[model samples]
Target: MSLKCGIVGLPNVGKSTLFNALTKAGIAAENYPFCTIEPNVGIVEVPDPRLADLSKIVNPQRILSATTEFVDIAGLVAGASKGEGLGNQF
Candidate 1:
């Protein structure tokens, strides 16, 4: 199963920075608020020794690692739940 995660917080709260560090996508993180209007998605493979052991035991042609998806959305502001900022849209 694939796991999904989201990085959300107030404007300019290092959400993109955290996503960049996690996925290394480097999708332009700036100091200004709302730098990321649209949500940025990145997938990272999870490394597990159990998977390798299973691969060796099953001897499959190819072994695929599990993945986790990270989404970096626009910063949320007060009243975001009320559709104040772009966070609601994300």
Candidate 2:
């Protein structure tokens, strides 16, 4: 199973920057509020030498690396709990 990590923070807080660095998804990280309405999902391969060694030893037809998912949710503004600034839809 793949692990998922969600990035949640206020606008212009480097949430997208971190996500992009982690996943290299090239998502738009604008300086304005509510720039990302829909969440962006990215899958990243986890590097493990043990897994590679096992794969080499077993010689599986298809070697699949462990993966992690990163999700970039829209920025939450003030009064978000009360349905403000992109609201609870996030």
Candidate 3:
């Protein structure tokens, strides 16, 4: 199974920026709050030289690198549990 990662934090705290950098998805990182209401899902290739070497030795038809899923969710505020900042629905 693939691994999933969720990015959660307060508004305008660079969470989007980090996600954009990691996934290169060109997601907008606005300066204001609540800019990212919907979640941004992306896959990142995991770099492992050992895997490449093993593939070379085994001579597989194709080399598929492992991947991880990154989910950039909306920001959370103080009252997120109580529906603040749109709550857990994000």
Candidate 4:
């Protein structure tokens, strides 16, 4: 199974920074709204120090860890879908 998550909030809300920290994508901090149409998606490996310990205890053939994805979507303001102040066009 696969899972996905999206990072959404007001502009300059630090969404990209948070996504970069989570996914380590190193997205450049250029002009606001980088990739106005596309968002920066990052896949972050879950940090689990106990996975190996558990594997050793269980003597499993393999040790697997989970991962998470972070998406830095363009900021969407209130009533955006309704075209309220440069909202519908985006």
Structural similarity to truth (TM-score) of each candidate: 0.89, 0.88, 0.90, 0.73
lDDT of 2 at 24: 94
Residues 1-90, candidate 1: write the lDDT tens digits: 799999988888899999999999999899998899999999999999898788888999988889999999889899888887763897
Candidate 3 accuracy as lDDT: 0.91
* lDDT digits (tens) for residues 27-67 of candidate 4: 76455653334677777777789887888889988766787
- Tens digits of per-residue lDDT, candidate 2, 1-90, equal 789899999888888889999999899988887778899999999988898788888998987788999999999888999998888785
1-90 in candidate 3: lDDT tens per residue? Answer: 478999999999998999999999999999999999999999999888898789878999887888999999999999889988779895
Model 2 per-residue lDDT at 49? 82
Full-model lDDT for every candidate: 0.91, 0.89, 0.91, 0.70
C-alpha lDDT of residue 8 in model 4: 77
For every candidate, C-alpha RMSD to the true structure in Å:
1.4, 1.4, 1.3, 3.0
Select the stronger candidate by lDDT from 1 and 4: 1
Clash number for candidate 2: 0
The number of residue pairs in model 4 that clash at the backbone is: 0
* True lDDT of residue 85, candidate 3: 74
In candidate 1 the C-alpha lDDT for residue 23 amounts to 98
Instruction: Order the candidates by TM-score, highest first.
Output: 3, 1, 2, 4
- Cα misplacement distance, residue 71 of candidate 3 (Å): 0.6
Estimate candidate 2's alpha-carbon lDDT, on a 0 to 1 scale: 0.89
Q: Which residue segments of model 4 deviate by more than 4 Å? A: 1-3, 31-36, 83-90
On TM-score, the stronger of 1 and 2 is 1
